[model samples]
Target chain A: MARSTYTLTIPSSTRFLEDARQFVETHAQEAEFADTAVEQFKIAVDEACTNIIEHAYKGNEDHHIDITIIIDTDRFTVRIRDEGESFDPTSYKEPNLMELAKKRRAGGFGVHIMRRLMDRVEYRTRGNVNEVRLTKFRNAEHRRNGDQA
Target chain B: MSNFSVGFRSSNSIKVLDLQGELDAHTASELEAAIQKCQDEQHYHIIVNGRNLQYISSAGLGVFMAYIEEVREQGGDIKIAALQPKVFNVFDLLGFPMLFDIVETEEEALSKFHDAHEEG
Candidate 1:
């Protein structure tokens, strides 16, 4: 199978999230992913980008977010790079649904949604750049069978 | 930019908000402000009509999460109705149905509100 990659860069602003989402969706479709999987990828990327814009850039519209998506036979990966403050995704705890319902907390749901939709999520900071990568397997059953081989 | 808008109305004492276009992190604040207006007026029984809404991100879902407890605490509830399947999937993915009253039509939501209010 041939490997394919696509890259997009947009200002770190909420206004550009729709464009970003469409970009991811288009590439995911081109890779022949299922419609449901494509939608999950779009949502996962949107949440990741939104967090970079809101938390990393602190809502600064001037910074830029670089997104790269690579599609292979087995899986697809989305890498987001932002020049902003570093954030440790591992340290963030999933909010308790019962407690959140009772408290009605306004934020903290973005990361949870991203984690639930994607198969893998990783975060790292390289000097001034913050990088977040999300991955989804094309065929979970196939991958599981292959792992046994 | 995504074309997003929110309109407000009242039906039988239930506040209804008609949303259109995309609701993401950027456009979520508009919906937030609209909900805030409803809260300020002490209108707790609310129904959000999402039939026209095309897309929604987690941020959009968070807006409802933000206000639900307070609204419920005031002896009212926030019910979502008429959501397109695609839009509803976002909420469903996050287990929103467990936390919200989502129905197939705005009428159902309004009726639910009225029934609860009458019973109480």
Candidate 2:
């Protein structure tokens, strides 16, 4: 298991979310991860990109999202980068199903979902660029340790 | 071009929507629009058949959440049925089973609607 990295760049629009999903599906499968892990990566990556497109870029198709997949012996990592607005982790609140339903809201689920599916969801801001790294452990023991990510 | 579509039909007075293709941020609006049409027509006893639906994202699930409370308030409910295991897993991950009447088959969902009508 040499560390292998794959990258894809898509415009900041919802339309390309499917493309981002397929990109993860293809590479994750190629990495020979279990079907369940592959599915998890596909969804976590989709949620991350959906957040970047909807909230960070704010529907501005002029922006682009940079996705880098790093396959390591211990983990499968996805690094997403955007030059648009940075996400404020402190402002994020766990969504309550009843509260969202009462408000008739359609969003606020992407971040929660991304964190749910990935073993580690880390966000950082470097200058004007924002990056979020979503990682899933390659081994069962490691995955169990990340059960709460 | 969008790779998703919603087909509308009726089964025993309950509106059924056949969802095909991937449902994500790009395609959630179609489901929302379809559900909206059902709501506007006062057809709240809705069954979403996900047999042919191969993929889904949180945005897709959000559509159901956004409308479920409203429809239920109107004395109607959105029932999801026949989802592929992968899609159902996503719903489960979000605790949707607790909030939604997710069944294994469309007939199962239809019967629930019928059962409710009988009780009412």
Pick by lDDT: which candidate is best? 2
Query: Tens digit of lDDT per residue, candidate 2, span B52-101?
Result: 99999999999999999989998889999999999999999888998999
How accurately is candidate 2 docked according to DockQ?
0.81
DockQ, in order, for the candidates? 0.68, 0.81
Off by over 4 Å in 2: A144-149
Instruction: Calculate model 2's interface RMSD in Å.
Output: 0.9
Chain B TM-score, one value per candidate, order as shown: 0.96, 0.98
User: Evaluated against the true chain A, what TM-score does chain A of model 2 have?
Assistant: 0.93
Number of the top TM-score candidate? 2
lDDT of 2 by residue, A93-113 (tens): 988887888898877888888
lDDT of 2 at A92: 97
Complex DockQ, candidate 1:
0.68
